[model samples]
Target: MDIAEINLQSRYVFRERISLMVLLCASSGRGFQVIPTSGMTLRSRSEHHLSNGDKYKDNVNALLLVATLVATVAFAAGFTVPGGFSSSPPNLGMAILANELDFCYFLLCNTLAMQCSVVAIVALIWAQLGDPELIHRAFHLALPSLFVALISMSAAFLFGVVATRRSHNNFLFNVVFNTVTAIFFHVMVLLLGPYVIPQLPGVPFL
Candidate 1:
């Protein structure tokens, strides 16, 4: 009578109907015929659900815009290193941080962020192409790629900050900067780890 009981009853009835349908299909010689129809019906329903919904389209477009922007920033960051580049003859216009370990870390993080953002953009574009299956796959790919891109961008930012001031002898500044970076990293992991980790493929459930 109540909503909970009603929901339970509805689910039970639905399961019963599905089992009965399966049984009938198996008993009939038209089992193969039923399978394609069921699959097509499911696909059609999914496509309609994704395409006909204005909210989904709007959300996807917003995400696409954000991902594209992040990708652009990351790509630009890769070309312009912290502290500028050396303009000397032998090392004409090479990054000044080229020899530093943190610079390498920054480059790796920035490159990863750029690559992941690009992938997320691609996935969003694919979702807009009106294929339900592709849309599903796109979400699976986009969410994780966007998560990684965000995390990597944060790392790149931290490393870039460190690389720029590494030559300074101000112990207090270094300590404060490192503390802030640590806090930022921890906050990001705490906020995003739960959502991103479980969604990743091949992760074993605890």
Candidate 2:
């Protein structure tokens, strides 16, 4: 190579070395160096993971509380059934409206609610073991179980009320039935409408 070309190449190499030295010096302090890009990325990932863990814990705690409450109420309802127990010797200790269709529905719904809540409780307990993958799977199971428990509990309440009411209180029964049905519909819409609305062609907001 010519001297001029070699001189130019040397200048370029010197400039690159200077730039690299400056960068290195800027990154190094008295006793420590700034984190490299890979280190920063790992730190950010750790932070994100911790944040997700906290969020999962919060969700589990809230759902656990709700499941516990539902289980408690359903257990109590099983013992003190609608219309109370029969006092007569022939049918003592039996639910008074046990033969009624509405009472049968109430029992079925209550049992479903209790079972679902118990499942949710168990799933949420598994979610607390501090493993991200396990926590995610547990939440998947717990959320649907909790939702079903809530729905079943509401249905049980409605059926129990109906079974205990007298025919003379027809107006009151209608009011109660309408109120509960409306509330159920409202909740279902709030929970499921987002998923359902987009699937319908030309449908507006729910």
Candidate 3:
């Protein structure tokens, strides 16, 4: 081949390699569209864990869940009372149902609303950091709780697109409570201080 022809072929190969590297980096850097930053294939996998959408369909598990709720006064007042003999735990139900009129306030600040706020906070941070995959994975640590918080409250507020606090406790109260909690918990434990999450059985930090 002529010298010029050989030079042209080399340039083509170099450009092709550069293109592949760029694509790979883009995918790894952004993570996933779920957070508007997950552009890389590998990063997406890190954000979604197998536990994110697991089914809790076992009848015994369901029964235990309800029993636990009924026993909330006995259990979680201390935040760790499975034996029912522990000191009176904070009554989560009471916290949840301050007044029939104020029920939205309690649930929203405590559940779904709180969750959405958390996701938004993390999403903001993720975006701010130029969307790193590691940050996305750290955020995933709270994904399951965030999802439950939303569904539980949404179901409670059946007809209300969002609960509003005109005269009664509304959606906004909960939205702030839950969102702030999520952001704080996830960012503190997973993102900023992963080592802080306790390895104990029922601790809630993680």
Ranking by TM-score: 1, 2, 3
Candidates 1 and 3: which is better by TM-score?
1
lDDT of 3 by residue, 140-168 (tens): 44333334443444344431323333444
Model 2 per-residue lDDT tens digits across residues 1-206: 12222232212243453343333334343333222111111112233445545545666688799999999999998998989988888998888887899999999999999999999999889878766666656655666677778878988998888787778468876987788799876987577333112122222221
- Candidate closest to the true structure, highest TM-score: 1
Q: Which regions of candidate 2 deviate over 4 angstroms?
A: 1-52, 168-172, 192-206
Kindly give the number of clashing pairs for every candidate: 0, 0, 17
Tell me model 3's lDDT, rounded to 2 decimals: 0.36
Mark the 10 consecutive residues where model 2 has the least summed lDDT. Answer: 35-44
- Ranked candidates (lDDT, high to low): 1, 2, 3
Model 1 TM-score is 0.69
RMSD of each: 10.2, 18.7, 18.1
Report, for every candidate in turn, its global Cα lDDT versus the true structure: 0.67, 0.65, 0.36
